[model samples]
Target: MKYEADSPEAYIDLLPEDRQEPIRRLRKCILSNLPEGFEETMSYGMIGYVVPHSKYPAGYHCNPELPLPFLNIASQKNFIAFYHSGIYADPELKAWFVEAYRERVPTKLDMGKSCIRFKKPEHIPYELLGALCRKISVSDWIQLYEEKISR
Candidate 1:
């Protein structure tokens, strides 16, 4: 579900009452562990963590007007989606996350290239997500994005 929100607070406000808290918790988890250089904003209609243009003037390769996105979280139609670009770009990181998730969460992981979907909000693994957020710094993401993702 795409919400037209101007800010992260607004995005949370727009979600269903039950979804708000989980999204807020997920947002907090990411914010608390995210590296210093990434900024929080609304991107692709979700709450996004990105390397601001102030840090990388060239901005996102696909669209120079927007900041380079590192992560995003959204309340989707049937689940909560956590999108981490790092896991999609780095094979080692993806493998680590897959293994760690199996060890930490009892349910089967529902994941895509960059999106990790949690069908039950109560089952969302906040600690593992926090650790994932800490795994890559803004500079490290920039380097990886340039090497593996950018055209």
Candidate 2:
């Protein structure tokens, strides 16, 4: 995929009806709590919240145009995915995510380096997920990637 969404609204509109609700709910949860420097856009075929690489310029994998994104939630063709970079970016957050996922999700969900997949809105723990989304301030996220590369 080209990884482009015209706007958050348009992106959700593209998804199927069943997909729309979960995406909408997730979008609401994320947008309501994002940090100041973070931006929401459609990227990678999903709703990407970019943590502009400029604010935390010292530790980007590439150019400074990139930002530290905490979560990238997208309504895929088959499922709704909640990508939380914090799990891999910060160890403490990873542990917390594990505990939260186990305690709240209660499903044998698959995981990527930082992505957590769920089939629907009911699968997500709104409050815990909201808290997770809120924790990734631009500064903390930048420090997270910096700490990653330094290792």
On TM-score, the leading prediction is 1
TM-score between candidate 2 and the true structure:
0.84
Worst 10 residues of 2 by lDDT: 58-67
lDDT of 1 by residue, 5-114 (tens): 99999999999999999999999999899999999999999999999999889899889999999999999999999999999999999999999999999999999999
Q: Residue 45 error for model 2, in Å?
A: 2.2
14-128: candidate 2 lDDT, tens digit per residue: 7777877877888888888777788887666678887664565543365444554556887765567888888877888878878877887777766778877776557777777
Q: Model 1 segments beyond 4 Å from truth?
A: none
Clashes of each: 0, 6
Candidate 1 positional error at 115, Å:
0.3
lDDT on C-alpha atoms for all candidate structures: 0.96, 0.73
Candidate 2 Cα misplacement greater than 4 A, ranges: 1-4, 57-60, 63-65
Candidate 1: residue pairs that collide:
none
